[model samples]
Target: MNILILGSGGREHCLAWKLSQSKKINNIFAIPGNAGIAQIAECTALPINKDNFPSILEFIKNNNIDFTIVGPEAPLVEGITDYLEGNGHAVFGPSKDAAKIEGSKVFTKKFAVRNNIPGAKAYFFKKNDYEKAKEFIEGLDAASYPWVIKADGLASGKGVLICNSRHELLEALKDFFIENLFGKSGEEIIIEEFIEGFELSIMCICDGKRIIPMEPAQDYKRIFDNDKGKNTGGMGSFSPLPFVDNVLQKKILERIIFPTFESLKKEGIIYKGILYGGIIIKDNEPYLLEYNCRFGDPETQVVLPRLDNDLLELLVNAGTGNLGSTELAWSAKKCVCVVIASKGYPETFSKGDIIYGIKDYSNKSDTLVFHAGTSMDKGNIVTNGGRVLNIVSQDKTFNGAIEKNYNKIKNINFDGMQYRNDIARKVAEK
Candidate 1:
């Protein structure tokens, strides 16, 4: 079957790589794919975005693509699935209505309340109601020193800020409401009470009814090591978290995932494709932090590597609502994905620097360098975005996987490359 994936990041590259390995797949394509994806699938250089849906539809038809999978949230939030399905095409993603769970934090918060889904305590405030927001924060005791201030709309993972004090929370609000730091994304805000806990990602395949949960993966969102600094998409990730036992998994499925599915159903929206739960576990209980309509970036880089089944067939069946009869298999090996980013990522950084030492990785066992922000410039691969590449490796043990990944990561270098050295350190120690 001919498949077309949308996006130009490591997640899309991993999906393309997995699909290329499928025996049933005849051809695969990616729109605006990075350099690494080009190695496995036909990378079509198209300016794909929300407004250019018509052009993408034409491309799908011309290429005779049997299935189209969206890898990013932007297009899904912009109603790409509805547009494609309306035009009689097979597409894998949630509708614009269903995507609100990821597109709008305020929407998800309200939905969570209505559905009795477990989550952190939050209060909604619009830009015009700045005084109300300040008053709400002032009302909180000193115990809530670290407050989570989030922009209601998507801001590429930088929308949420953890304020260490009242002064910081006030400053963040001023930036959002007064300074307009995030533009339209910050027009509205959600001041959620901060919950201290270990975070993990739970991705599931939902065929609008039955939900098939994948293995748990924990990602380090902070830009620096030891979980410090601002969030930048994600820094690194690992699968088979030592903390997520059967009890915790069952709680997440029953308390969060099921209600989320039922909530979407109540709204008359059949949520197909991936439903990623950004969860925080505290006191042996799970709390929903956020949701992504599609797959997680660095998390997918690690999770997909541990899959023992054909990814192409699983996604296709889910897209067609035939996933009830299908089952997925996973390898026992632990997987780790360390993100290589520009030196000053999540802030200011340089691009166009020549990257080296990736081509040699093909000879390495169980190691894959999935490109995130890269492009071929005059026969040389160069950095093109903040998070550049994902160094993924798998082994029988989590510590072994982490060791193997970091060893190979040292060989690959760009002018301003940076990565976390202690990825999955806490979990691996246990």
Candidate 2:
């Protein structure tokens, strides 16, 4: 079948790679795909947003595209799925209303409270209520020093900040309200009690009724190693969490996943596609951190490599609302993905620096390079965004996979290139 993918990032490239391997696929196309995706699929220069919906629809019809997979949350939140479905096109994503779970923090918080979903204690405030928010924070005990301040709307994963003192908290609030650092996304803010724990990523495929879980993955969000520095899209990720036993998994599915789906159902929203929970495991118990309406970025880079089933078929089933009792298969091997980003990422950084050593490992069986922010410049591939590329390796052991990634990364370089050195380090050591 002819398939079309939306967005221009590593996630889209990975999706194209997996689907291209499916024998059932006839032709693959991507809208605004990056350099690596262009090598395997037909890449077009169409933007994936509400303003280009008509043009996107025209392209789909002209190319007789049978299915479309959305890779980013922006278009989904802007109602692309609703529009495409309204036009009778099959799409693998949630409707705009369902996407509000990710688009609005206040909405998700209220939904969690109403459904008794376990999460951090949070207080919401509008931009005009800075004084009330300040008063609320000042009334809190000093023990809650490190509080999480979040923008209610999306800010490319940089909206959440951890304030360790009253001075820091007030500055963050000023950045949100007075400085307008996050634009309209910061119009509403959430001051949440910071839960101390390691974060986990759980993605489930839903068909408006039933849900099927994928293997759990752990991703590093901070820009530097050891989880320090400000957050970026993602720094690295690994799959098949060594610490998550069946019991903990069951609790997450029961307490967080089930209630989330059922609650959405009660609200008359039929969610079809990926329901990704950003969960925090504290004291062996799971707490909901946030939700991403689609697959996680670097998490997808690692998770998809371990999946043994035909991804195209699964997505088709989910999109068509016929995902009946489907159980996923997975490879026993471990997978690791490390992101190669431009220096000073998650902030202002230069672009168009020439990259090297990618083609040397292009044909390696154990390693795969998925491009995120790259473009063809006079026959040379150059950096085009902050998070540029993903180097993924799969092996029978975590140590083997982790070693393979680092070894290959040494040969790849560009001006102002930066990456975390400790991806999956603890697991490999163990």
Candidate 3:
């Protein structure tokens, strides 16, 4: 079958890589794919947006693509699935209505409240509610030091900010309202009481009726090690969390995942794609941090490697509402993905620096390199975006995987390269 994957990031590259391995697949394609994806799939340079939907559809039709997998939230939030499906194309993603679970933080927060889904206590504010928001923040107790301020709309995973003090919160509000840093995306905002806990990314395939949960993955969002500094898309990720035993897994599935699917159903929304829950576990209780309509980056890099099932079949089944009879299989081995970014990522940095060492490890059985922000410059791969590449390694133990990635990463380098040193250090130490 001919398949088309949308977006240009590590997640899309990982999807292309996984789908390319399926013997049933006749051809694989990516829209605005990066260097790594181009190696294995036909990379179509088309902008993935609402205005470009027609062009994308034309390409799909021209290529006789059987299935299209969405790899990012932007196009999904913009209603690409609805458009494609309207034109008689098969797509593996939620409709625009269901994508509100990620598109609008305010919408998700209210939906959670209506569904009794556990989450952070939040205060919603409009762009015009600047003074009102400030007044509310000023009256808050000093004890609640770290508040999470988020833009209602998508901001490429950079919309959420952790303000540790009243002063910082006000500044963040200014950035949203006054400075218009996020523009229309920040027209509405959510300020929530910070939930203290470790974050887990749970990605489940929902076929409008049944939900098939993948192995849990833990990702480091902060650009610096020790969970410090600004948040990038994701710095690194590891699968099969050591902390998530059977009890915790059951709790997550029962309390968070099930209710989420039911809530979407209650809204008359038949979600048919990946329902990614950004969950925070506090005292062994799962709180819904957020919901991503599609798969999680870096998390996908690790999770897909641990998947023993054919990715193409799973996605096709989910898209066609045939997942009720589907069961997932996972490898016993652990996987780790360490992201290599530009020196000054999550902000601004240079690009077009040649990358090396990929050829040496690309053929290895235990290692795989998935490109994110990369491009071909004069026949040499160079940096193109902030989160550039994902260095993935698999092993029987987390320690082995972590060590393998770090050791192999030494060979691949570009100017102004930066990555987290402690991806799964805590788990490995245990």
Candidate 4:
């Protein structure tokens, strides 16, 4: 079957890589794919924007694309799945209605409360209610100093901020509501009670009813090491968290994942495709941090490598809502992915710097260099976006996998290249 994937990041590149391993797949194509994805699949200049829906449909018909997978949230929020499904195309994504769980933080926060889902307590504020929001924030107890201000809409994972003092909180609120830093995404804001705990990411395949959870992953969100800098898309990730054993896993599935689906079902939304739960584990209990409608970026770079199943068939089955008796198997090995970004990432940074050593390093066994933001520039690969490449490595042990990746990362370099040195140190040490 010919497969078409949307988006141009590392997650889509990893999806393209995993899907290519399936015998059922004939040819794979990515819309506006990056330099690394072009090595494995046919990269087309086809735009996947909502306005170009007709063009995508035409390409689907002409290319005999048997299935399509969406790798980003923007097109999905614009009703890509609804549009594609209405036109008799099977798509691996949630409908716009279901995608609102990610698109609108205010909607999802209220829905979670109404459904009794376990998550952080949040107070939603509109753009015009800055005073009321300020009053509410000021009234909070002293322990609530560190508040989380989140833009109700998507901001490429940079919309959430953790403030340590009332001064910082007010500044963040000003940035969102007063200064309009996030634009439409900040039109509505959510001030959530900050909770301190290590974060966990769970990606599951859902067919409206049943949810088949994949390996657990932990992603570093901050742009700098030691989690000290502002949040970026993602800095690095590792799969099969050592701390999440069978007991904690069962607790999460029962208390979080299963109930979340049941609540969505009660709302009459039939969710199809990936459902990502960002959780914070405190005192051995998992609390829902947030949700992503699709796969996580660096998380996918690590998690997909551990999958021992035919990803193509599974996604197709999930899209059709038939995923009957299809159990996914995963490798016992551990995986790690360290994102290589342009200097001053998650902010203004120079691009078009020539990158080298990727081709030579990726030739190693159990190692892959998935491109996130790279383009071919005059016969040389150059930095094209904030996060440029994911150096992925797999091994029987997590530490070994991390070491292998770092060893390989040493050889890869570009102008203003930056990456976290402690990708899996916390988990590996524990």
Global lDDT of each model? 0.88, 0.92, 0.90, 0.89
RMSD in Å for candidate 1, one decimal? 1.6
Of the candidates shown, which would achieve the greatest TM-score relative to the real structure? 2
Per residue, candidate 4 scores C-alpha lDDT tens digits across 42-63 of 8888777889998999988999
Tens digits of per-residue lDDT for model 3, 392-420: 99999889999999998898888889999
lDDT of 3 at 109: 94
Q: Distance from true position, residue 80, model 1, in Å?
A: 0.5
Clashing pairs in 3: none
Off by over 4 Å in 4: 360-364
Ten-residue segment with the worst summed lDDT in candidate 1? 358-367
Estimate candidate 2's RMSD in Å: 1.3
- The residue ranges of model 1 lying beyond 4 angstroms of the native Cα positions read 360-364
TM-score, every prediction: 0.96, 0.97, 0.97, 0.96
- TM-score computed on alpha carbons, candidate 3: 0.97
TM-score of 1: 0.96
lDDT of 1 at 123: 87
List model 2 lDDT by residue over 1-430, tens digit each: 9999998999999999999888799999999998899888899998787999999999999999999999999999999999999999999999999999999999999899889999999899999998998898788788778999999998988899999988899899999999999999999999999998988999999989888889999998889899898878899999989889999999999999988999899999898889999999899999999999998999998999889889999999999998888889999999999999997787876689999988444533888899999988998898999999999999999999999999989999899999999999889846
lDDT tens digits, residue span 1-430, model 1:
9999999999998998888889899888899898888887888888767679999999999999999999999999989998998999988888899899899999999999888898988889998999998888778888767889999998987888989988888899999999999999899999887898888889999888778889989888888898788778889999988778899899999999988998789889899999999999899999999999999998998889888888888888888788876677898888888999996787976789999998544523698889999988998899999999998888888888888888987788789799999987776855
Tally clashing residue pairs in candidate 2.
0
**Pairs of residues clashing in candidate 2:** none
**CA error at residue 262 for candidate 3, angstroms:** 0.9
Candidate 3 least-lDDT 10 residues: 356-365
